[model samples]
Target: MPSLMDTYIENREMVQPNHANNLDTVHGGNVMKWMDEVGAMSAIRFAGKSCVTARVDEMDFRRPVLVGDTAVIESYVYEAGETSVDVYLRAFRENPRTGERELTTESYFVYVGIDESGEPSPVPALTVESEEGERRQAEALDGLDA
Candidate 1:
């Protein structure tokens, strides 16, 4: 089983023209798609099996990620059950010129492991055995309200 940090997956993509709205800010749907993809990556890495999105507990856009800015997505496994894993996803806007980044979105996603037959299956235990890992897991679970 992958540990806390080891189960993390990230992706940084540029906000293209089609990814923006009339105001030139990244579209909310596009951000949600990115978050779902990155969260799936973490879930797959942790469970080592095919998984499906069971539910999105909450997704809230704190700020807009503008076009030309790098959309940095960070995701990790926070909790796991017999056949489900909870993932915490965060999106940030990275300025190309200053190389600074700021949080823009946050959400918690749940995925269920699937077997070769496409049926839900149990996943292995997760290891959150470090100080930072424990803190992050706790922080992610602080408020499911998003």
Candidate 2:
């Protein structure tokens, strides 16, 4: 079994011109792609196998990440089923120099572990062992209703 915190992963991407729109804000698609990549990493960590995205719950863009800002993507496995891992992801726009950050986007993703032949494989159960892990799991579950 893997503890929920053990599956946590964070990635950062600079919002270069190529990744942004004419308005100078990072594109919505690019944000989603980053979230998916981080979420998959968390799932793979929990499952110890390759994982494919099964579903993406509603995504809400709270703010925009400017071209010069850093997009920090964070993800963790909060729950797991027989062959699936449920990950919660959050994206923040950060000012590199000041270290200030603001939430830009958030979503829930489900990934299914895969075997060598690409068939669904069983995943280890997720354990919320620490207070931080329990709090994160609670927050993710609560967010589902919003």
Candidate 3:
């Protein structure tokens, strides 16, 4: 069994000119791309197999990452089913100089494990070993109600 902590993933990308929109902030699509990549990595770590995006829950762009800032993405597998895994994803804008961080986006992503033949495959069971893991799982479940 893989614990949720084992599947934790964090990544950061510097917002460059190419990554920004007309407003000089990171584009929403670029942020989504980053989220999906990190979310898939978490799912693959949990499942120990190839995983593909199945769905993405509502994503609200609450803030913006300026061109000189860094986009920090965090993800973890919070729930699992027979062949699917649910990942909790959050992104923050961090000031490279000040180290200040602000929440920018959040969403739930669903991924399905795939076998060697590209068919759906069973995923490993997720074990919540720590208080934080339990809390993350609970958060994922609570999101379902919203």
Top of the candidates by TM-score: 2
- Give the Cα error of residue 55 in candidate 3, in Å: 0.5
Candidate 3 residues 1-146, lDDT tens each?
Answer: 99999999999999999998899999999999999999999999899999999999999899889999999999999889999999999999999999899999999999999999999999988899999889888887787787
For lDDT, the strongest prediction is 2
Candidate 2's error at 38, in angstroms? 0.6
Residue runs of model 2 more than 4 Å from their true location after superposition: none
The parts of candidate 3 lying over 4 Å away from their true place are none
lDDT of 1 by residue, 105-146 (tens): 998999999999999999989898889899888889785643
TM-scores, each model vs. reference:
0.95, 0.98, 0.96
What's the lDDT for all of these models? Answer: 0.91, 0.95, 0.94
Preferred candidate (lDDT higher): 1 or 2 = 2
Provide the lDDT at 84 for model 1. 98
Return the candidate ranking by lDDT, descending: 2, 3, 1
Query: Candidate 2 has what TM-score?
Result: 0.98
Total residue pair clashes for candidate 1: 0
